[model samples]
Target: MKNTYIPITMEVEKNYFETSDRMIKTLRLKFLDERFDFEPGQFCEFSILGKGEAPFGIASSPFDKAGLEFSINRAGVVTKAIHELRIGEKVGIRGPLGNYYPVKEMEGYNVVVIGGGFAFTTLRSLIEYMLNPERRGKYKSIKVIYGARNPGLLLYKDLLENWEKRDDIGTYFTIDTKVEGWNKMVGFVPTITEEVAPSPENCYAIVCGPPIMIKFTLPVLLKLGFPKDKIVTSLERRMKCGIGKCGRCNLGEFYVCNDGPVFNFEQLEKLPKEV
Candidate 1:
């Protein structure tokens, strides 16, 4: 059996800043062996020699053959080390670990994607997967509502522009406040979500963002008629070990590292009130 604790080495093919502030960087890693197969919403433990390891969502789609992508925010020591990594440097990847978004179950329904700040990484994976030609026919309408503090903080600007030009999906980009030369909506993510007001009928709404953003957004989704079971979110916070062996990432009886990182509102409700 493949050892979950041992990491495989992969070369960093590309690494660059995602935002103008330089706090967040996107890394593309080339696989040395057969590529690790993973669904969207899954995360991997990224490791650097002497620097330590951290968990981050895989930002590239399953159909993306070039490499695995991770958008990392320079928040702590490991992440700071990750940001300093150069192209051609070797790194360790522990897994396509943890549970993933229910792509198969969501196939027949319309998809509404909501994101904020850098948390949009995995959401991007899900979107790209659903937009692929082979998968497009499986789902109905797709709508995306994303927001960042400012235009400069938005991740994947080029892809967002391309998505805006596509007719197959509806994209709503927003910011926390208005600024000169900005043409997108002016407001927070939850506000924009309420404004976009995607119908919940035969739909699944996937949300990922900071706790504050999600705290307010859930009420809006519920008010707009999304069932608790149909509203999915990722609680990837505080995850140290990517496997369930560590007890740190639990929410009631569920371990975020094993049982989730992804959970519907109905499931979350059953967890401890701290969630």
Candidate 2:
């Protein structure tokens, strides 16, 4: 196995704002020694030299193998430095680290994806994967319930618009409060989820968002009769080493970076609530 500590240099190809303080950036990376294959919910440790590094989920689909994308929030020194980076600037990437969503197991089952705020990144990847021509046949219905504080804050507008027009998948978009010029669903994610009320039979629910959103959404999923194992989620944590060496992301011997970032509701139930 290759040493996980060292990082491969990749160049920033493009970047654009998703929210006032969040940016979605694309990177062009070359992995000659190892295959760059990764699952939808996996993440990479993005590093800006002399600044710092942070774990960000891979926001692009695995089908797009040549390039990588990340949705980063401008909340800290490292991300602020990342925001200043121009096209063609080089940065260090030490992943596709962490576990991934259980796409293989989900084959032949309906999938419902729920997301909120800027945390929609990995969910976007999962949606793209499920929508891929080769992969779509293996899955049944695909429904996405995505929301942010406002219309301007939603990520992947182009794709969402296309999904809205397509009959292949059901798409619903919402904001926390009603805004002028917006005519789609308007409510908090949990409320909108209750209204939509997708069935739990033979369906897998994958959720990723802020902690509070997860807290409230779990009950809704349970009330809908989703089994613990069928309800999956991806977690965000303060991860450093991108491997088990760092103790920061541990939850009772489970390292979020190496062991997870992706876990089913049953698995999460067994762990401490700190995450």
Candidate 3:
């Protein structure tokens, strides 16, 4: 087999503070002698030479030609190092890897997007793709339900605010607890999902979050008549190699990097509970 590595050098075009401890960076990479092309829900392995490499979902829409964005939380050594880097710094990108969300198949069906915390990265890409003017009419309607531990921790606050005001898509935002001057929904994501109870008819649901949120949310989706095949999610695993050969990101024999980072609930049901 050929070595599936790209010696692409990318520069950090910009960076923004998402939270006190987290930063989102946009990197400009060239592939095929042009901007890198990737689909929603796919990931790229980022390397900072001596620091190390880590897999992060592609947070920008495929239609976006600006650059690729990644949400990095300051929770680990590698990430801590990455967080300290400045704009114009150089880094290595070795992907556009893994399977992507079934966007084409979702045409003509309503989409329910459920997300929580930082896990909402790729879902943001999915939403942007769905909302694009060129691709907007392909689907019926879009309902977004997203939440974070608190208002301060929410990612993409600016974009979420604008989305809430748009009539084309139905947007719901929640925080785990109530605070002064807050007016939107205040509750766990699963609770809000059950309350909204978006009809499962002709709809496809995509969910991503911490494990506990997913565990509780899936049952609600099923209760609301969403078939397992129609519900999708991306798994967060420690994938050392973007390829399946690493043997680290396996769920019952399926390598999350190779087989999926995106999988429908029906496909998930056939895998081990450990994923």
Top lDDT model: 1
**Model 1: number of backbone collisions:** 0
lDDT of 1 at 219: 99
lDDT score of residue 76 within candidate 2 = 80
* Residue runs of model 1 more than 4 Å from their true location after superposition: none
Q: Candidate 3's C-alpha lDDT?
A: 0.86
lDDT of each: 0.93, 0.86, 0.86
Ordered list by TM-score, greatest first: 1, 2, 3
Top candidate on TM-score is: 1
Candidate 2 weakest ten by summed lDDT: 24-33
Candidate 3 lDDT tens digits, 1-275 = 32567546777876777854445433443333435678899998988888888888888888977678888776677787777778778878777889988999999999999999999999999999999999999999899999998887888888999998999999889999999978999999999999999999999999999999999999999999999999999998888878888798988858999989999999898887676
Write down the lDDT that model 2 would get: 0.86
TM-score of 1: 0.98
Candidate 2 per-residue C-alpha lDDT over 1-275 given as tens digits, one digit per residue, 9 for 90 to 100: 77788888777777777665355443444443445778899999889889989888888989987778887777789988987888878888888898899999999999999999888888999999999998999999999999999887888888899999989899889999988999999998988899999999999999988899989999999999999999999877787798888698888768888889899989888888786
